[model samples]
Target chain A: MSKLLTDLIEALRCLPGVGGKSAQRMAFHLLERERERGLRLASALEQAMQRIGNCTRCRNFSEEPVCSICASSSRDRHVLCVVESPTELAAIEQATGYRGQYFVLLGRLSPLDGLGPEELGLGLLTERLAEGEIEEMIIATNPTVEGEATAHYLAQLARAAGVKPTRLAHGVPLGGELEYVDRGTLAHAFGSRQSL
Target chain B: MSKLLTDLIEALRCLPGVGGKSAQRMAFHLLERERERGLRLASALEQAMQRIGNCTRCRNFSEEPVCSICASSSRDRHVLCVVESPTELAAIEQATGYRGQYFVLLGRLSPLDGLGPEELGLGLLTERLAEGEIEEMIIATNPTVEGEATAHYLAQLARAAGVKPTRLAHGVPLGGELEYVDRGTLAHAFGSRQSL
Candidate 1:
């Protein structure tokens, strides 16, 4: 294979779930079938990187200092949803039609990996909590250890600032089989069962 | 979402098997974490697209008029492999360790899709066979209807030019279960059983 082609394939492996074979397939697909779109993707990536930055207010992606969601007056300023990444923020927005602003941590607290609260923009989160505009902070982080720890840390900060903090409900997912559900999730679901 | 961010996400959807969610994830991954590598990928895509063109000799991708495989003196010029795409050519080269030169059709004979002999580089294939340099032509097109038709068409061309043409042997794959094997493969395996 050509060096340039190989380099492009290798670079595509940096994507979230792309492996060597997938990266190669993506590369060849670009070259053989969608060269024009591939070039457009290149331009889009370049321009997005050159212009888009973390929103100064919410830390989500934005072209300006504040993201559109953060800048919008129609959104609920009193209800803030905290997420570990922009993907999670988007998921919440899409799935639940969440009309509140978001605070993107960009990552969770991983002490072993040297990721601290400072690294996850917890200082900015504290500043937002202290602003007194937010009535509730919903923690929408994943169920992973780091995510849970980060959520706990953020909840303490919110509590200190006299803002109510809430974690997303834990339960067996809709349409999930009991046999296929993991032990931890099943236990959490059992413990959190609702009374009708 | 920012228009730039959304455009990048939309552009990433051009990749094979990438859906909207995956495209968004890829876009976010590029923007949030791998910006440097993302820029490198953009540069690689642009450079590869600007420089890489079809190899005049075999029609595989090349920065020059002829691809490295066709230009190489180390590969066998007498044995040529006909493939439907460059990815298949690469697969054959990797799996079979074949040292023969290749003729990449870039597509198969899909008459229903308006693809014909000219579209498959069969004219170039015939011209190459008529040169008397090729002693054998291996038909390595996929086992689909279009691939079979392409192989049959190329075989007639090679035979007319007095070049021997052979199809890949069909058999039950290595480590495959006989009970799980498809009927067509089982029949082919039985028909082409080898003498130990």
Candidate 2:
């Protein structure tokens, strides 16, 4: 194989799930048939890696200092949503009608991984909470152990800043069969049953 | 999402087996963690796309006019192996100690798909066979209908050029159990049993 070809196969393994065989296939596919698209992908990757940065306000990925969501005046400034990562923030935007400002944690409180409050920019979040423009803070962290702990910490911050804090509801997922649902989820759903 | 981020996700979809969700995950993974590797991958892709072209001698992918396999002096020039694609050529090189030279057809003889002898670079292959340097031509095409037809066509070409033609033996695989093997393979194996 050519050095360039081998380099491509090796480099493609940088992707999340790609391994040696998959990388080889991707490399061959690009070389044999998709050279044009492969070049375009290279350019896109270069531009993205060089230009994209975290938004100053929400810490979401953006080419500019402030992301479009954070810069827009039409979104609700009084209500702020806090999530663990840009991926989760995108999920909220796509799946719901969330029109509020966002605060991206970029990670949960993984002390073992050395991702502490400072690493997640909690100080910046605290400053935003104390700015007096935000009346309500919604913590939409995942239901994991670290996420719950992070939510508790954020709620304390919101309260300290005189802002009302709320958490997303968790239970059995919509349209899940009770018999097929996991025991923990079923139990939690039963415990939190709501009145009509 | 930023346009650059979205464009990256879309551009990543050009890779084989990657869909929207996987592309999104790959984009986020690159942005959050593997930005440096991602940039290196970009450079690799660009170089491979721009520099890698087919070997003039064997039609295998190469940065040079002739691929290393075809250009090497140690490889047997008298015994030529024909394969459908560069992937199959690489497979043969890895799985076997076949030190013979190679002629990559790049595609099988699928006339319905408008792939014929000329499209497969068979004219170049015939010219090589006619050069009298090759004494034996090994057909290593896959055991499919199109591959068989291509092998037969290549055999006739070898005979016209006074070169001996041989096909890869087709039977049950080495580790395959007789009872579990498919009927077609079992019958073929039984019919072709040698006097060992």
Candidate 3:
């Protein structure tokens, strides 16, 4: 086997779910049939890795210093939604008629994993809350242990900042991927949110 | 969402089994965590797409004109194995000690899919057979209808070239992936090959 071929296979294993066999299949599929697409993917990867950065205000992925959502004037600044990750933020965007500004936690409060409030950029979030532009802070974190801990911490921040805090309704299934949950369930959960 | 993030997700969909959601997960996985690996994968993909080409003798993927297996002086020249794909060739390499030479068909005789003997590089195989260097030809195409057809055509070429032709034993489960067969079954099948 050629070293380049081996390197391609090894690099493909870097993908989230791709293991050794899958990496080999992907490598062969590209080399044998999808070379053009493979090259396109390479360029796309290069461009994205070099260009994309977190939104300075919301911590969501963005190529700009402040993401479009944070910079948009049409979105409601007073109704803020805080989620553990950008994936959940996207899910909310797709599943509901949400027009609020967002704060992406990037991760939850997992002390064992060394993910504290500081690591998750909670200080930035507190600053956004204290700015007095946000009236209500919706805690849209997943119902996991770490997520709940992060939500409690966020609720404290919201209360300290003199903002009303709320949690998603029980419509969301426990321990489920918030992004993959049914649109109706997620929408309903967002619509009928309860005070924390 | 950033346009580059969307482009990255779209580009990731080129992988065989990846779909919209998997593509999104891969994009986020890379952006949120594995940026370094993502860049490495990009480089690998670029190099492989630009450098890897067909081996002149075997039609297997290779950076060189002749693949390592075909160029190796230690391998026997009197026995040649005909496989439908490099994947199967790799399987044979791992599952059995049978070593001589190989001719990768790249595809089988799927006429509906526009694949024929010419598309499969049978002309090169025929020229190699006509060299009278190979005393036996092993037709290791899969047991699918198209694969069987390709094997028969290869057998005819071997007979015309005055070389005995053989086929794998029944130990290969019909319609199953040749590369994923258990080591015992594949090794036994190769060891107990029968004359076609």
Candidate 4:
């Protein structure tokens, strides 16, 4: 193989879930089928790398220090949704019809993985809470152990700061079959059943 | 979303099998964790796009008009292996232990898809056959209907040019169970048994 082609294939392997064969397919597709789009992807990557950075307020991706979510006046400043990543934040925004602001952790607490509250931007979250603008915080982290630990840690901080912090409800998902539902989720759902 | 970040996500979707969610994940990973590698990927894409083009001799990717395979003095110049694409050619080189030069069709004969013998680079194959340097042409296109049709057409061309043409053998793959094998392949394997 040519040096240029080899280098491109090697570099493409850095993408998530991309392996040697997939990288080769991507390289060939770009070179043989979509040269213009390939070049555009290159340019976009370069520009995003140079311009985009962590939003200082919420830690979501942004070109400026403050992201659009943090800067917008239409959103509810009093209600903040805490998420582990920007993708999760976007999912919540779209699926749940959330009109409040968001604080992206970019990761979760995993002691084995050397990730902790500080790494997840808890210090920044505390600072925002100290400003007395946020009335409530929703822990919208995933149900995984790491996400649960991170949410608990954030709740402890919120309690100490006198801010109300609530977790997302855990129950049988809508359209979920009881037979297929796991024991843990079923127990949680039964334990937290709402009274009509 | 920031313009650069949004553009990056949109551009990443051009990769085969990558959807919106995967593209977003890739974009975030590049911006947050792998900026240097992302930049390297961009540079590699740019360099490959600027330097690589189809080899004039065999239609494989090359920086020059003639590819390295076509220019190599060690490979058998009198024998040629014809394949549907460069990926197929590389696969054959790696798996089959074939040391012959290759002619990449780059596409199959699919009239419905507007691909014909001319589009498959058969014109160039014919011109090369007319020169009389090749003694045998191996049809290694594929097992699909289009590939079989292409192989037959190439065989006719080789016969008219007085060059011996052979198709790659069809049989049950090694280590494959007869029960699990498709009926067509099983029949072909039964019919093409070798002498001990």
Candidate 5:
């Protein structure tokens, strides 16, 4: 193989599911008709890294210190939606009717993986809640074991801080991700939910 | 989403097996830890498109007019191996025991796909065989229906040119790709004989 082809294949293999043969196929496809697309991907990576920042209060991806939702004057300041990742934040945003501010933990409390409250910036969340403006905290962590543990821990933390903490409901598959679940199902899950 | 993030997700979605979720994950990974890798992929795509040319003799990917095997002094001048694409040519080369030169068809004869003998440059292959240096043409096209059709057509072309033509041994798994099969299996497949 030419050095150029070798390098392209190597780089393509860095993708999550692409193996050697698939990477080679992708490299050849890019070499054939998508060189411009490859450049665009590179440019996008650079631009996102340089331009996108974390929301000041929520720790979610944002172009400004306060994300659009957080800056929106109409959103409910009393109801805070908490999530584990920015993708989940995007999903919740896509639901299109939740006019509430958000706080992204960025990760869950996985003790075996050495992730603790500090690692998830729970201190910052506690500080934000201590201001006493927030009336409710909705935990939207995943339904996995880590998610449950994180939600339980955060509930205790919220109680200590004198804030009522609740969790998003979980019953339907929601098409595999809480983010991708249909709006109606999510609305139902949200409406028929029990307090944590 | 920012225009840059949107464009990046769009570009990443073009890759095979990369849906929206995977594209987002890849975009985030590149943003976090693979900036250099993304640049390398872009550079490699540009370089391969600019530098890699088809070998004049076999139509395989090469930096030179003629590929290394075609230019090599020790390779058997009388034996020619035929493949469907440059990737397959690389596979045959990596098997390391094929001391013959190659002929790449670029694609197979798929009537349903409008890929005919003319489209595959079979006329050029016929002309090459008529040069009389090649005593044997090994049909190593994939074991697909289109591949079989292409091999049969090439066999007739070789006959018309008054040169002996043979095919690679079969018993390769149906619909399986040569690139993923191990070297030992490939060697066995290449060694065990049955004429098609």
Candidate 6:
């Protein structure tokens, strides 16, 4: 009932899946055992937002201008794996042992939600393709309808720029989030994939 | 990966039903949007711990030495309802038509967990009942086995104190939490009840 308690609970409810009861329980725990914990979380959020900028080359989150993967000479510079968001990129990094560099879209092609090619930074991607160092571009967007549409649009853009484009497999379950899938499944999905 | 971030996530994981994923989500949300919210929760927790003292008469959480309900001139002085926790008391209060005072056990008779009458402040309850203001003591502890045992033990205490001892009706689902039940179901359970 206190203002501080109410605000904490309300703010906790802003998470993707947290509900009112969960928010209350979280607030109670934070209040009871970890005052320092809350401050740490605040710092983490602020630091992550400030220090982790979009990689200039791949658009993945990184403290430097180019992410570690993109900067690494060991990685395959000719192969590029594209993804939607940082969370999704993290999920892919966790699941796959891919040595290729990445390019993050930050969002999918959701015309209905007003997310178009410009919003997804497709112009920059096309410019990168025109540089002609990349031999293959793997569309690792989700298997959702929006992901498919985004991949289709990216394929057209790649063709226009005289670059070869490919997509990740489609055997993943419909409406399934990449984060929920196991590493083995993701790897297997990646291994026996077809070009689209 | 920071120690503060790790500690914050661990602290968030201490809630009743929160898991690693939910805890991470909560930690992120608190960091992103709830800096003020987190501070508020911290303050509330501290304030509740500092200000909420046990009511001398009922052993329930209260800002005053004697809770507002126990000190109220309008509440039924002769009737008292006993519950397992402050959360349960809040639930009953939200049901909103009961004017009787309350006694919170703070815990049930979990012998395996080493909780007994004395440990649960039953001695204070006995001393309070000896004052003779209460004519009836209603056992509203949970319907769990330990709760039943606690109610039975308290009923004996109430009888020995020379007051009418009553128990809230059963059939409100064994092991079901009172706080989660709908208001109508709780009202129905309260209305059509048999003595334990």
Tell me, by DockQ, which candidate is best.
2
Isolated chain B TM-score per model: 0.94, 0.95, 0.83, 0.93, 0.79, 0.76
Candidate 5 chain B: 10-residue stretch with minimal lDDT: B38-47
Clashing pairs in 1: none
Model 2: per-residue Cα lDDT over B75-137, one tens digit each: 998999999999999899989999999999999999999999999998899899988999999
**Rank by DockQ (best first):** 2, 1, 3, 4, 5, 6
Task: Give each model a TM-score.
Answer: 0.89, 0.92, 0.84, 0.87, 0.71, 0.67
Candidate 1 local lDDT, residue A73: 88
Cα error of candidate 3 at position A176, Å:
11
Predicted chain A of candidate 4: TM-score:
0.91
Clashing residue pairs in candidate 3, if any?
A: none
**How do the residues A8-58 of candidate 5 rate in per-residue lDDT, one tens digit apiece?**
788787776779988887876765556677666656655665677787878
Query: In model 4 chain B, where is the ten-residue run with the lowest total lDDT?
Result: B89-98
Chain B of candidate 5 versus the native chain B: what TM-score?
Answer: 0.79
DockQ of each: 0.71, 0.84, 0.71, 0.70, 0.30, 0.15
Model 4 misplaced stretches (Cα beyond 4 Å): A109-120, A144-146, A177-187, B109-120, B175-196
What is the full ranking by lDDT, best candidate first?
Answer: 2, 3, 4, 1, 5, 6
Off-target runs (Cα >4 Å) in candidate 1 are A109-117, A176-195, B193-196
Q: Write the per-residue lDDT of candidate 4 for residues B75-181, one digit (tens) a residue.
A: 98899899888888778877887888889999988999999878888889889999888999999988999889988898999999999999988998889999999
Q: Which candidate comes out best when scored by TM-score?
A: 2
Candidate 6 vs. true structure, TM-score: 0.67
CAPRI classification of candidate 5: acceptable
